[model samples]
Target chain A: MNVYLMIAVCSAVTLVPRILPLFVRTLDSLPKTIRKCMLLLPIAALGCLIFPLSLTDFSSSWYAGLVGVVAAFLSSYFRRPMIISIIISLVLTTLMLVLFP
Target chain B: MNVRRKSKAFQVLFAVAGECEFDENLIYSIAKHSHFWKNLHGKGIVLMQESTLCAKDGMKDGFPIFLGYFTTALAFGLLTRTSGLTLVQGVLISLTNYAGSGQFLMMNLYNAGSFLFEIALSVFFINSRYIFMSASLYPHLIDKKSVVKRILIGFGVTDENFAVSSLKGKMLPFPYMMGLIFTAYSGWVSGTFIGFVAGNFLPPVVQKASVITVYAMFASLLGGEVRRNAKALLVLLVSGLSNSVFILLVGIPTGFSFLLSMLLATAFACFIYTDEEVFGV
Candidate 1:
């Protein structure tokens, strides 16, 4: 694929959904079920992004990703700041790689 | 006060200050305490300060989001190099498509030799979630009547800013949304640039480990959701587990699998989730 054309196509696709609501009519009249279901999209997509994909992110050791995820979850559960959670995850992932390799 | 009185009061305040020992602060305080100033404020002329203050508040609330996007975009920058995309291409991708997972999936599918249509299809599906966010925020616009401004402000919606914006019970001023989105976007683009360039200097161990930062952000966001609604835990699990199944066992591609998994979880939510619980009404 020509990279520029591909980027254009991808960019246009992403931009439409976000900008569409402004042009269209109000969304308040949508069916309750559909609206309620839509509320689940961000949470569901976050889950889908993390599990299988995060599991495979590390090439050196699967355990690295696993450890990083655990650290991230633990910090996040405690309601520590977001940057703190990322740092904790990054540190642990790096530690795992250093020690195990 | 009417506009005439208001202007007269400002002139008197300035005149008094000019005649005095130049106590600008005293003149400002006098003008603020004047009945004319209070009357103008009462007539809804206090918007300029409040709007600027709201933008400042948005920036404060957006700081964490800025941090999250920075680290994640660093990872994205790292991935862009591995994906054989130029620095400009990577930056353009970040600028145009700020959706985190959708951007990653775009490059991944591209690297996998998927056609432009395939990339677009999957990206559209993954990013389609933003439509609902935009919809949810539409009613909160400070100036919703203008289609041109609506379209302009609509572009500022993102997952993080949406979360923040949705939490506000008041009307969302354009300046506030712009402040929030601007902070986060700068973090993303700058992080991508640094990550792409730093790839040459960073150790391999650290480079490999940075990928988890993006995942860590997603986890933190999910954590926020679960904290808000405990039942969201079920949706997260169902969506995540189903995604794994679809990709590993069923051999579905990432884009479709993600949407399918999301659908299954939303279906589950429909059965158990309450209107009050979901909408927090």
Candidate 2:
């Protein structure tokens, strides 16, 4: 695909969902359960985003990625900022890779 | 791990770029100086109002997020260059799409030689959460914005902007939202450009190490969410385990596995976890 076309298509698909609601004011009229589901969508969607794909794919060293995951989990769970948590994990992972490789 | 399965770009992009927002001090200053300020002042005693047009505050809100976006977007550019895309394409993706996960998916799919329809479908599904976010935020927006202004704001409604505005808990002013989005947008695009130019200059070892950023971002993002909402831990485990099983054991296609796992996890969360339990204190 032409890169421009790809970007355009992706932009359109993303913008449609975001912009459509601005025009449609009846969203409040949606059923209660549906609204609740919408509220919960983030957790579920985020769950699907990280697993099996990011946490497990350690081609060079699984141990490196595992340590990174643990570090990330601990830092984030302690409510550290997102960037700090990520940096901690990266540092740990890099150390492991350097040591093990 | 299969090289195809090692699509860290999409997963990392989605994880960190998902929930972000910043303060609106800079925009308030601009709006205060603009002709729009005259209209804002004409309506009432601007000083007495809870939300003054001269609200030259909250500038620090997005600074932290800006740093995060800069690093991730930089990583994104480096990854794109490594993935065989030119600098222009990487920058264009950030500038136009403004959706990190979608851009990553597009590049990953393009590299994998997937057809346009398949790429579109995967992106659509991955970003489907935006529809819900928009709907949930609909009630919180001010009623006075014109259609054009609303459309513009809507385009700027990334996960970060939405999360920040929702936390503030009021009708978001157009200028404020614009300021927040524009800051983030600039950070992302500029970071990508810098990464592209400097990507090759990095040592080979540093370049190899940069790939771990995606997984680190993912784990950190998930950790934050799970901490806030403990049930989200269950949701994460369920979806992650299911997706792994479906993709690894059952040999389901990546796209299908992701959608199925997401759908199942969302449905389960909806049925089992109440809003108070999951989102409430």
DockQ of each: 0.48, 0.47
Task: For each candidate in turn, give its C-alpha RMSD to the true structure in angstroms.
Answer: 12.3, 10.0
Compute the DockQ of candidate 1.
0.48
Superposed on all Cα atoms, model 2 deviates from the true structure by an RMSD in Å of: 10.0
- Please provide TM-scores, in order, for all candidate models, with all chains considered together: 0.73, 0.75
**lDDT value, residue B275 of candidate 1:** 60
The sequence of per-residue lDDT tens digits that candidate 2 reaches over residues A30-86 is 665765565455457555555565544555467776787778778877767556766
The TM-score of predicted model 1 comes to 0.73
Superposing every Cα of model 1 onto the true structure, what RMSD results? 12.3
Report the lDDT of model 1 for residue B279.
Answer: 53
Q: Runs in model 2 with CA error above 4 Å?
A: A55-57, B1-51, B54-65, B100-119, B132-146, B165-173, B279-281
Please give the distance, in angstroms, between residue B66's alpha carbon in candidate 1 and its true position after superposition.
Answer: 4.7
Worst 10 residues of 2 chain A by lDDT: A51-60
